[model samples]
Target: MIGIADYLDKQLRDYGIKEDLSILDFGCGQGNYTIPIAQIVGGNGKVYVIDKDKTKLNQLLVIAKKVKVDKTIEILESEGQFDFDLSSESVDLVMLFNVSCCIIGQDNYPEFQKLIHELHRLTKKDGKLIIGIKEGKTMLNRVETGIPLISKEFKLDKKEKGKYLDGEKLRNGIFYSLTKK
Candidate 1:
């Protein structure tokens, strides 16, 4: 059984994540991507993990400690809003994996737009924003509809379609690599 961290590592490498670059894992849940990202970034780089759930952040810290990469991971607790306290152009990579659709769903378009703008501000010039959405009817619909809005703030670099085994299920998804323009 492949773990989610391993799956995320493969996807990130496929999307061109390099070493010694600061990263931000927005909506990071339980450090799935955070740990791998920290490993990729090494000691010189940093991976900022942000999520609204404190419990999850704590779990991420423990995992980081267990992995002996806690120094490379910074945990931040969000207020369930797009308002982040980080400086502009502070990070080289920002990941919005499997969470953007929830922000842009039927009742959250405004929040989604706000997050897009905020992400743009947080990303360094030429930095990358990678968005991954699970390939499901509802999620696909939301991503397609939201792409236009997202394009206003980011230039779509490229996209890749793929699948990964998640426990007993094969989860199909698309990875959108967008650049700050």
Candidate 2:
């Protein structure tokens, strides 16, 4: 069985993530994708992980150390807001995998657009924003509304079908790559 990390590594490669690039793993949970990304970017790169849960952030750091990629990772505990303490256009890639829906709720569609704008602000010119959404009608519906806002700052590069291990079951998902205009 392909594990979540392996699955995420494949997806990152498909998105053209390479060595020496800085990355922001927004809403990074337990270092699933974050660790693989650190490996891919190698020692010359940096992976900044942000999550609301401090415990999860600690877990991520532990995994990074276990994998010997701790030096390449920088972590921050977010307060469930869009404020990121980083300079504009400083990162080469922003991974919003499985984080869109959680950050954007049904009652706050406007806030979703604002977050997209913030993501755009954080991304370097021509940098990539890779969004991964779980394959389901409800999740799709929730994210569809923000497409236009994303389109305003990014060009739709491509979309691919992928799978992620959710608990014990592998769930299908869509990965959207958008390049900053």
Candidate 3:
């Protein structure tokens, strides 16, 4: 039932990122996976979790306090628009977990391009972008459209589909990771 979070944590640990590494979870919903990441990064690291919905973030703040890791999370309310207030080349790792399509929607809106550009702008040269989109979604379409908006922004390293069991059933999802190149 909790396969996604476990799998994501395993993948992140396998990468051998530093404990003090700065991470950003874009469109983090309810801090499900974000909390685990925050725990792994430890007190020395800074994990910035952003969601467009302020109420969801408020709930996460409460949960974070309960877990006593609230200090590590810089929860912020941000609209999924181009005007994301962040300095360039700042973050080391950015996780776009099931969040990109949710933010831009399926109307072929150019904001997807702006989002990718902003993420790229906020990433260091060696930063990695980890994205997990649903099986049937607009991420691929957004990728097609995003090419022209920001040339050489990011390169898709690998993508795969797998089933994680959920209550005696199989729940399928697609996972993809990219790096700024």
Candidate 4:
């Protein structure tokens, strides 16, 4: 199994995110990536972790406290949608790892467009947004459809596929690094 801390460092190195960069992990499940990022960012930087489920947040809090990493992660219990609940243009990076489908639901319907718009709203100018998901027809097709929605508000900086971290292959999943123009 890939350790969360190692995975976080590898991903950051791969993506070229440096120290002092603030990040938001949308749908961060139970501090899997959150704890590692907290350590990676050090005391100077911050990580905002948002999830729709309160139980998961509580569990993450416990893990953070037990591991002495609670101070680095800001746990936000998303009450409405997967909204960040932070000030506009505040974050440096928004990480949507395996979260797009969960937020939009797996129904393969049309409501996902709104989620795409919301992602655009939360990102800052020049801020990078990274999204990762499994290989699936629905996810692949949704990315194709959602690209147009995001393009309306931001410009794509880079698009990559088959990127792997900690023995995990991103496969059909795509990570779109977009900047608000």
Per-model C-alpha lDDT, please?
0.82, 0.83, 0.72, 0.70
Order the candidates by lDDT, highest first: 2, 1, 3, 4
Error of 2 at 149 (Å): 2.4
lDDT of 1 at 161: 88
Candidate 2 Cα RMSD (Å): 1.8
lDDT score, candidate 3, position 96: 77
lDDT of 1 by residue, 15-70 (tens): 66778889999988777677888898899999988899888898989989998999
lDDT of residue 29 for candidate 2: 85
lDDT of 3 by residue, 25-45 (tens): 888877766677788888999
Off by over 4 Å in 2: 1-6
> What is the lDDT, from 0 to 100, of the residue 30 in candidate 2?
83
After TM-score superposition, what is the CA distance of residue 64 in candidate 1 from its true location, in Å? 0.8
**Each prediction's TM-score versus the true structure:** 0.90, 0.92, 0.82, 0.80
Top candidate, metric lDDT: 2
How well does candidate 1 match the true structure in TM-score terms? 0.90
- Candidate 3 TM-score, true structure as reference: 0.82
Off by over 4 Å in 1: 1-7, 164-170
Which of 1 and 4 is ahead in TM-score?
1
Sort order, TM-score high to low: 2, 1, 3, 4
The residue-by-residue lDDT of candidate 4 on 53-134, one tens digit each, is 8888999899889988788788765774635567777777778777777656655434555665666676677777777766
* Each model's Cα RMSD: 2.3, 1.8, 3.4, 3.4
